[model samples]
Target: MDVSYLLILLLVGAFATYFSGDKLASKVALVFALASLGMSVYILNLFNAGQNIDFLSAWITQPKVAFALKGDGLSLAMVLLTSALIPIIIYSSFGNEYKNAKSFYALILFMAFAMTGTFLAADGLLYYIFWELALIPIYFITLIWGNGDAEDRKKAVVKFFIYTFAGSLFMLVAFIYMYQRSKSFLIEDLYAMRLTVKEQTWIFGAFFLAYAIKIPLIPFHTWQAKVYQKAPAVGTMLLSGIMLKMGLYSVIRWQLPIGRFAAIEHKNIFIGLGIAGVIYGSIVALRQNDLKKLLAYSSLAHVGLIAAGAYTLTLDGLRGAVLQMIAHGFVVVGLFLIADIIYRRYQTRTIGEMGGIRQQAPKFTSLFMILVLASVALPSTFNFVGEFTVLFSLSQINMGYAILGGTTIILGAYYMLKMFQQVMLGETNKKAFADVTFNEGFSLVAIVAVLFFFGLYPKPIVDLITPSIEHILTFINRTN
Candidate 1:
């Protein structure tokens, strides 16, 4: 049982898509994504059977690293989320033909390859390689296929590339320092080493800089909205749907277990930052006239709560954080895809210019409303499960932290429902609007179905990740 099949399936899909010719590239990519999804299902089943699907081989001997890839409950859950979303992402792109279509679809598959690798890599150096690998395709995806003013888009892409790349370099330096001390890049080796509080503090900062920029917490989130607005819808889905979780996943798998002392020491500081982001992002979202920009801020607010939950370092917090990561991944992709729909039909993302869409397209309106509700964490949606667990975890820390963090629900409902009203309600626009094409409708339906299904029965995911959370918490609770 090998977990690398997921990666191989995607990498092969990328190359296959490239040579499949433009006419067939998207279909080929979709098939590849579906294949990856099937492989993920098989891996999940094996996981349930108490099997370990791992692969290891020599990579770079000097670094004492191997091409080690393994799946525990945690990594596979992230992998499954990434796998499930890629097909929907590819399917969503069916309405329009991209220039250099083969290359475009190929890059999408390639990004999946890099991202799946990031989730499963078991060695620090291996993870770093995958981490850097994930950055390249997105730079090209945003730069080559993006929208908006060419100059502004270029600046946004470059800023993102530099900012994330710089953060990765910092993390790599920290890994190298740890490798020097432990003489191995295996995650277990890194975890086994005892560090002083000062040492843990610096390493924590290094990983924090990397993950924060990726999560784009509060002040570090300057790159997010512009990038989301400029990139094509498929690109936006990839970023919001899957790429952002890579950072959150790394925080759990890499940062906390390795730097447990610092995590305990500064838990309150990070938790406060997370709450600030929740309120700040929701308020800013309310002010955005652009639909994509509003969704961008909304994403920031939701992730802020998740990050705060992760910082709590409690079983409930970790459980909720992972659940929220999965829940947010589904809902945001739907919202952004809906924004892209408006952009395609009206040729404007300005919310003011759009109205009465609901009258014109009842089906679209209904689906959009459901996703909006899910985003605001309505009970019975998957998001509600995650949000409740996260808030409960925070309450255990302090009633104040829970109270402040809980504002995102009220604020999320405020901005999201308001945006829904402006975008979907009102009288039919003077200009004509068409209903969703089969392709678009299908993708939205599938995404919505997953949200509703998990919202009702989130027990499967919660159960699967609990043992792994407990495994990680052991180290987090240990003081040197």
Candidate 2:
């Protein structure tokens, strides 16, 4: 029942998939992904039962680091999201044939392993290691299996690698500084340790640079759309779905608690930066010609709002941010998979080339429409619950913040609905469009069911995450 078992399962799965031969790699990887999902659920149940599930052991004594994994409502919720979506992401790719399938599938599990570790690690050094580890698999996945011109893909992927990697170095520096002051790499020690205003500002700025680049807020977002367009569907799903959440989660887990002075001192500026990303991303998304690139911008807009909510530093804001992270993860995966399905049939990513699919593929249209509605935060959908709370949290801070943040809804609906209209409606095209295959439809349905189930009755999730959110808020309020 140790939390480390989850990491072990995925690591073993990656190696097994790599050696399983290309013919069996996909199926083997799927089985492993599902098993990991099952294990995470079991751990969640045990967590609720108040059983001891966290793991820690001595590692680097000089640095005071431990091979540590901790599970709380917050970390476990993110872990469950990662474990759950990975199976669907792996399944969604069954239709396409990739060269070196073993390596491709192996990297998927490897990436999942790194992401899960990132969520669960409690020691600062351990967390940073896992954070960086998550990047490697995705880097190879995009470079090897990506969709566009080889040169362009390389440039985009490399730029992403450099941006994220460089940003993380700042985080590392901050962590080292914290360790110097606190004399331990444990997150709790770092959080409890005191720092002068000067120190807090430097640490906060370093962590902000790291997370913002990964979150890719407005100015730092140049690397995002290109990378999404170039990467394969699965890579895009991992990036948009689970990878970005790492940055947001760290904002709550590491940055706010460790650097509360700076977080509080510059709250408005940080919140404004997030809202700006929302408006900027929404406007840019309006004009995107490529489907994946459009969705990428849409993700930026949504994440910007989530970031804004977290910076509000209210219990409601942090809670809503977690809720939206889970909600956005599933919805974005479904959206990109839809884009990939259309590409499979039409062999193009351009919106101008697509039309009248509503006439030919009712099932696909229905599912796509549902995903579009969810993206815009329609009532009774999961996104609504999260978005409403986030905006409300912003309102408590300032009406202007809420108003600007709320524009995501108006602008999101305009762009997403317009994308849907252009892509799914209008005159019948000469090219024949087939309905989603059982595999594709089944995946979409699974995603839709989660959104609706949680949207209508979100109490279970709200309950599970509240205590942890409160715990983090305590540290955040310490600066006051």
Candidate 3:
């Protein structure tokens, strides 16, 4: 199957849905999403069979840059994720009454196109293009349809754009530096280029800054909470569920390999910062009264642990980080969706204002409880498997770091259970609350089923990624 052909299909679908009447726009979008998923699955099979799908040509003769799109295990995983989640997000929005469904579905499809391109682009410049392209539709989606005061929503959107673009510029600089050194823009060529310790350090710093900001690590994470609070729940789901993984994925795909020596030299610093983020994010979340704000902070804490795992540069560490990335994406999306459901029912996000929800919404309560367990790393949940692997890998480097990082589990449970109890267990409020609708229940059930399925059988993913990670580690070791 031609990857470019699939891309064109998605592009056409977006425009078709855009012009289609609002009454039929959603059905059109759903069809396109399913088609994209089918294409992604086909790509995955081809990738697993070790076939390379090239979509572009050799461009520049002097700098050795070519337009290319290829799917490896990592790219395939991301494509599958994007394809799977877009439809779910669309389905989750079925109950929403939008002013212009045509435009909404179109924007969603365009975003999907850009995200798929980001994962598959084989050239640094092309990847950067897709990376920025992915953000444009989202900006509009949030600005036009987001909650809260319109002025505040605009402010949040601008802040999000500035924060992300600032990081992206630094990443572009790193790419330019590599192109200069390797005389090629192909990622494979960049991986083969060698740099002095000083050069690697500087380049690594720039790349790390970009990814860290996207992951919204501490000190750079101020934009996240406000964005989550202001954006529509669908927008939040895309940002937390699929967009953040791009940052984490880049850390593994480019930064560590390109700056191998520097990464090793500064391992302690990364570990220390990650541990601080783990504690700080959790502490801050403990203080948040809004459910969306709390989940935003919780996401920060979880990604911090993923960053720590990446720095470990061991097989176990990388594997754990990869698994954790997928696990956290699913868990966070489910949690935010639940938050949306609660808000729809109670017309508020404040935990202080919610009570006796479980008495009225048994299905919502059950699903929310399961998601909460996953978030807190309870046994039998996917999060526990990922967290345990990461903690064990951290312990291999430093016992104290492991212990400190592990404290997030206890703090996580404290906040999660407290939030759950407040919303579900207390006396009924004066206002009447509706039970979970079938649509809402189906969405939550799908997410919970995935969480349990992956938790019990993560080996397939682990196996898929092992070869690529092994290849990367080998290159690093050889260079060292």
Candidate 4:
């Protein structure tokens, strides 16, 4: 039940799939991802049985950082989320053809490997190492395999690489500063340190700079839409689905507690910025004609609220952020997949060119409609639960913030329905509009099934992460 088992399975599977040869790569990758999900379910069961799963070994003794990975309720939830979704991501790609199928699927597994590490790392240096490790595979994945013009994709990819890497440097400086005081990179040791207000402010600034750029609060979000547009469906899914959560997770686990008073002091400022992103992202999304770019902006809007909820630091806000993060991950994957589906069938992503897809494909229309509704936070969907909780929490802080955040409901509905009306419900097009195939339909159905399942009864995940949320709140509330 050690958490390392999950990492081992993923890393080994990456290599195995690579060597399995192109003929067998897709099947091998699918089997590996499914096997990993099966193991993860077992781990979740053990965790629910009130057992701890941890692995530790001496690593970099001079620096006093152990190869430490810990699994508590929070980390386990994220790891579970990553594990559960990888199979779906892999399966969704079954209809597509990648030039270098072996290396492509292998990168997907590698990205999951690094993300799992980031979630489980109990030490700051170790966490940062894993954090940086993640950006590598994704860089290559997008740069080489991305769509659009090669020069345009290269520019977009490089800007993202430089932006995020530069942000990490600030985080490393903060870690080294913390290291100077504690002589260790263990999270607990860093959390236990007593720093002057001046020092806390500096650390907070550095950490916030790093995480904001990733969670991509307003000014820092410049790279998102472009990068998302260029990357292939698989690449886009990896970025939106699980990679973005790394920043939000770090915000709750590392940023808030590490800079408690600073976070509290400037919280409203950051929260305002988050709400602004919600508005800005939504408004911009309204103007986008390209299907993927529209979803990209919509994602920015959705995560904007999630980020605001995290900054609120209320129980409702934090819990809602967690729930919404999971919900949004599933919903966005389905949305992007639908976009790809359209592009594959119609050979165009321009919404203006798409019409009456429902006439040709009722199932695709139904599934697409559900995901769009979920994105807009319609009632009876999992997104509604998270959006309600987050807005309620923000309202408690400032009604103005709630009102601003609430615009997502309106604007999201406007753009999503508008997109749908134009694309799925209109005059029948002369061009053929094919329905989703078995694999594609299965992927979308699986996603919608989870959304409704948790949408109706989220108590399992809600109960599972409650203790961890309490643990997080304790550090944030500490006066020391």
Candidate 5:
């Protein structure tokens, strides 16, 4: 099957949604997302049938650049994630009425195109194009539809745009330097280049700086909380659920092999930074009253652990990191949706303003509880599997690092339970709040089912990712 057909379908969906009226626009978007999901599953089937689905060819003659799209286990996993989440996001917007539903849906479909592109593109220049392209729709989505003070939204959007683009510049420089050295813009060629330790370290630093900022680790994370708090729920879902993974994915795809020695040599620094971000984010989350801000900081903490796992360079660590990336994406999106539910009912995100929701919305409470448990890495949850694997792998590297890194679990529980208790378990205030509507319930239930399903049996994902992880490790070991 020609995978380019999938891209064509997405573009067609974008145009169709753009022309449809408000009443029908959402339906068009939903259909598009569902079709995209079907296409993704078909791609998986093709892969299972032992066909290499990625398409690559010459693009620009003068620069000798190629347009390459490859789907290894990692890229396929991300593609599946993007495909799955878009429908949920589109569905979650059911209660939200936009002035121009056509434009709104079109933007969302366009964003989907960019995300799929980011995951599939294998050439450095092509990857960079998708990298920047992915940000455009989100910037507009947030700027046009975000809540809070207009100035606040503008400030947040500008900050997010500038921060991410600035990081991309470093990535661009790294890619150009690699192309200059190797005389090719192909990803595989860059990976194949022989470089001195110093060169590797410099390139690694450049790449790491870009990805870290995008992942927004520690000091670089200042923009995330504000942005999440200000952006609309759909925008928040897209950014936290899908876009952040670009950074983590890039780290695995671009930085590891290119900077294998740097990764090993500076493993301690990355690990230390990861630990700090995890602990710091957790502590900061404990103090946050705004629901969105709390979740934002929680995301920072979770990504930190994943980052540390990536730096470990151990098989289990890398596996756990990739799994955690997937798990976190789902869990965070669910959590944010829960936040959106509360905001819809009570019109406030402040924990102090929420109480006794369990009495009115047991279903919401139950789903929120599961997501919280997952966030805290409870047993039988996917988060537990990922966190345990990462910790176990960290132990292989250093007992002390494992011990320090493991505190995220404890800190995670403190903030998560605190948030849950405040929002769901308290005495009902005099105000009446509506229980979740069917559409809302469907979205939550779907996400909960996925979380539990994956949690109980993660072997499929683990099995799928193992070969790719092994392939990446082989490169690292060979280069070292």
Candidate 6:
């Protein structure tokens, strides 16, 4: 089967959903999202069976770009993450009504299409195109469906748009420079080219600017909290759950490999930056009153650790980063949905206003508690497996790095537990908060099931991603 079929399926789904009329649009979108997920699982099986599933054809002969879609274990793993989350995100939104619902639902699928393309594209230009394409749908989604003041929403979304677009231009320039050196834009061609220290430094810096902003590491994270707070629950989920992984994934797949020498030269500084985000994000998350913003900062901290692990350039580091990325995707989506659930009942996101929900809804509280525990990397949860491996990888570099990174778990637990206490415990609010409905319960169950199942036996994920990590590590350590 052609890998491009996945992209085609979503694109067609988006158009079909947009025309499906508002009442049926969401359901249509869900069907397509589920179909995309199924297709991804099938493709993954084919890949595991050792069948070739990549698609490559000429697109622009002059610049040497190709319309190419390639899948390996790593990319397919990310694809599966994107596919799996889109359906859940869509399903999670069922309780909320939106104006012009068809457009909103269609944008969700379109964003998925673009994100999946980013994971699968084999050419640098193609990857960059998909990377940028993913931005458009979300921009509209947030602006149109977002919760905050129109002006505030506009400011946050525009800042995100400009920051990301500006950073991407740097990446585009880097790719252009690489194409000049190699005469091709295919990832293999770029990966194979030998460049001077000066050239590698420039390339890595360009990619760093792009990925850092998207991942929103400490200094580049100014736009994140506001956007998350303002956007609708589903928009926040897409951004936190699957969008940020694009940056971390690019680091392992493109940045470290293509700019091995530069990454080695600047590993400490970047590693410090990642660890800094972890501590800083955790501290700031502790202070946030808005639930989504708190979750946004929490995501920053987790991805920070993931980025640090990738920079460690060891198999364990990269492998753990991928594992945590998948785990975080599911867990964070559940967290945001929990926030949405609260909002649906109390019509408020302020943590202080959300006390005593446990008195009202046991099932919702139980699921929320599981997510909170998973978020803190409780030993039996999926996050623990990833977090422990990431911290261990950092230890190989320096004990201090591991110690600093480990603060995420301690601080994550503290703030998450504190938030839970304030929000779910304390005086039972006079207002009655509804328990999780069937759809909400189903979504939470699916996420919790994945976390626990993988937490106990991560071997399947480990086996799937190890070879690919080893392959990428070759490029990362090629010159070292």
Q: List model 1 lDDT by residue over 1-480, tens digit each.
A: 689878888999999999999999999999999999999999899889988788888888785788999788899899999999999989998877699999999999999999999999989988998998988889988998999888999999999999999988989999999998999898888889998888889999999999999997978999999999999998999999999999999999999999999999899999999999999999999999999999999999999999999999999999999999999999999988898888889989999999999888888988999999999999999999999999999999999999999999998898888888888888667888899889899999999999999999998998889998899999989856
Determine which window of 10 residues in candidate 3 has minimal summed lDDT.
Answer: 471-480
**Alpha-carbon RMSD of each model:** 0.8, 0.8, 1.5, 0.9, 1.2, 0.8
Q: Candidate 6: where is the Cα deviation over 4 Å?
A: none
Q: Report the number of clashing residue pairs per model.
A: 1, 0, 0, 0, 0, 0
Q: Is candidate 2 or candidate 6 better by lDDT?
A: 2
| Local lDDT at 147 for model 4 | 93
Predicted candidate 6 versus true structure: per-residue lDDT over 1-480, tens digit per residue: 978999999999999999999999999999999999999999999998999999999999898889988899899999999999999999999999999999999999999999999999999999999999999999999999999699999999999999999999999999998988899999988888989888999999999999999997879999999999989999999999999999999999999999999999889998999999999999999999888888999999999999999999888899999999999999999999999999999999988887988988999999999999999999989999999999999999999999999999999999999999999999988799889999999999999999999999999889989998898888777853
lDDT of 1: 0.92
Q: Which ten residues in a row have the lowest lDDT in candidate 1?
A: 423-432
- Which candidate number has the best lDDT? 2
For candidate 4, give the lDDT of residue 217.
84
Write the candidate numbers in order of decreasing lDDT: 2, 6, 1, 4, 5, 3
lDDT of 4 at 116: 93
Positional deviation of residue 411's Cα in model 2 after best superposition, in angstroms: 0.7
Write down the TM-score of every candidate. Answer: 0.99, 0.99, 0.97, 0.99, 0.98, 0.99
Q: Report every candidate's CA lDDT.
A: 0.92, 0.95, 0.87, 0.91, 0.88, 0.94
Model 1 — TM-score against the truth?
0.99
Q: How do the residues 222-276 of candidate 3 rate in per-residue lDDT, one tens digit apiece?
A: 8899998998999999999989888888888888888989999999999888888
List candidate 1 segments past 4 Å from native: none
Residue-by-residue lDDT tens digits, candidate 2, 166-249? 999999998998888888899888888888888999999999999999987979999999999999999999999999999999
1-480, model 4: which lDDT tens digit per residue? 788899999999999999998878888988888888888888888888878788888899787889889888788889888988889999999888988889999988889999999999998988999999999989999998899899999999999999999998999999998998999888888878898888988999999888888887888999999999999999999999999999999999999888988889999998988999999999999999999999999999999999999999888999999999999999999999999999888888889998988989998999999999999998889999999999999999999999999999999999999999999887987889878999999999999999999999999989988888888898888988
Q: What is the lDDT of residue 431 in candidate 2?
A: 94
Superposed by TM-score, candidate 6 places the C-alpha of residue 430 at a distance from the truth, in angstroms, of 1.8
